[model samples]
Target: MSVKKTKVHLISGFLGTGKTTALKSLMAQKDPNEKWVIIVNEFGEIGIDGAVLSDNGIPVAEIAGGCLCCTAGPQLGNTVQKMLRDAKPDRLMIEASGLAHAASVIDELKVKPLSEELEIAAVFTVVDPRQFVSPDYAQQALYKDQIGVCDVLVASKTDLCTPEVMAEFHEQAAKLFPPKAKVVEVQNARLDIQWLDIPVIEKPRYRLKAEVLPDNTMGFQSEGFTFPAGQDFDGERLTHFFNDLPKMTEGLVRAKGVFQVLGTWVWLNWVDGQWGANQVSWRRDSRFELIAKSFDADLIEQKLKEALE
Candidate 1:
């Protein structure tokens, strides 16, 4: 029997969502016998999270200047491969960018490079305790999507919010989240480190261990599309499309992409929400890729078709 225990834990949230604190807390609570490989990605040029995890002796591999969902895809994948080859750690934790959408990250695992080794254990998204009460969150599309897609949603920094505020936020967030994922509060900095030890990535008896790219996307049950540079279109309309998506979404884990078009080519961008073109028009081309655990592909297709048409 193979003696390798390769499982991946993805921690995704928007900026200042307390991913670092949650990771630090989780690492501190974990048993020393359990070795962990942390893959951290951020927009900042320097790798701060990796250094923090390093202080805890958790053998960290940081990938800076990109979100773990896309920019750091190869680096994260390679770092993970090397870790397995060298340290053979018991578990892996991917501290994704605060802005990362979990659906896209999980979708990457379903296809190439990562599928060979790593298996996702759990998906966690950290919510800033204060944001739920803020007017910005109440109106923002990304805020709602981040909370809705995670397998485990944490109302972090409970100490700051009053009991009533916490309770109301919990009720509101719970209503927005998927029925399957569990939501909890992390106030006392207490976390059940045991969850990592539980073989969370369910192994399929007959799994698809194959390399996938644009052409072979559909077979994986998690994939997206990319249009050529000439396919540039309206940006505001695109955003409006995604903004209205949350109402009809089903099984959408996470989705984000960077695109380019004339005058907008220099400014590469991303889209993450229930109602949006699952693409980014950055290079004068319409490139969009979406990854989901399981979602209403037909509905997504219908919407995109309507928007593009």
Candidate 2:
């Protein structure tokens, strides 16, 4: 009887492949009438994408840790529900983790007791310049699913490679999909609002099974830490402390959590750097959680201890 109040725009991509860049670009140009909320799988335990947007004065809701398709479903649903209730955004953009399967995300769009106000807008799958060619390429079922479901396929960093490679790349890649999706490579991934509304048939819903990860290489545990009233931490000091961690963590996949430094809550992110110096502050959310793929728990525990000391 009532029109859906918001449409969900799912932006699925792998880690560090420019989904954040595209997302921020689109959000900044939005008309105020079109309030947009972003659900990022990574809240910058590495880069400050979310913090930068929040600092620029745009509202972003992040559901990080593991892949959204696998790990953050409840958080994703709850965040969406809250956004519809509070901000009533004209569009909702969810940036799935690089490891995330877009099919699982679509199935989630059809969640039980579907909210009356939520409409499925479109699915955008982002690919890196090098993604389609790597040995790791075939391992990326998430990437393929991302493409198979997209109303728009965004190829980020097209200027860095040749048209021949890009074209051949697409031709080979096309074998992965049905003949319905469009692939458009961007110069620097400059996205406009019009790109957000391409129409495609709604995909068949996906079902997910529980995956038991091996304990040896890449798995993570999350715990919430709360600072009592009047607690204070030095932000600059905290950043430098974690920066020294890269040397200690060699096989680590990713690790990040929100914690207090100088009384301001900051997100600490890491992605297997030789050193953790590449980390940046998201400057939001007091609550923190960590995700690791192939990290040794003892090594991570040692690094974490060094951070707090």
Q: Name the regions of candidate 1 deviating beyond 4 angstroms.
A: 1-5, 133-135, 138-141, 197-309
TM-score of each: 0.59, 0.59
Worst 10 residues of 2 by lDDT: 204-213
- Of candidate 1, the 10-residue stretch with the lowest lDDT total is 200-209
Please name the candidate that would achieve the greatest lDDT relative to the true structure. Answer: 1
Candidate 2, 58: how far from true, in Å?
3.1
Cα lDDT tens digits for candidate 2, 1-309: 767667787777767668878887887778876667776776334434556556554567777666666657777778777777777777777777777777667656665544466666657777775776565774555555565566667778777777776877676655432233456777567777786666554222211111222353333432223333123445654566457544444434444444545533344566555223222222112232233333344554444444452
Query: What value of lDDT does candidate 1 attain over all alpha carbons?
Result: 0.60
Q: Give lDDT for model 2.
A: 0.58
1-309: candidate 1 lDDT, tens digit per residue: 764547878777778768887888888778777777788888777988787778866678878887766677667656778888888877888888876656566656545555667666666777766787677886665665565445566777788888788878776765441221456787654456765544322221112223322234443345454444334446665566556555545444444443333324222223353233322111213434444444566666566555452
Tell me the alpha-carbon RMSD of every candidate: 12.3, 16.6
TM-score of 2: 0.59
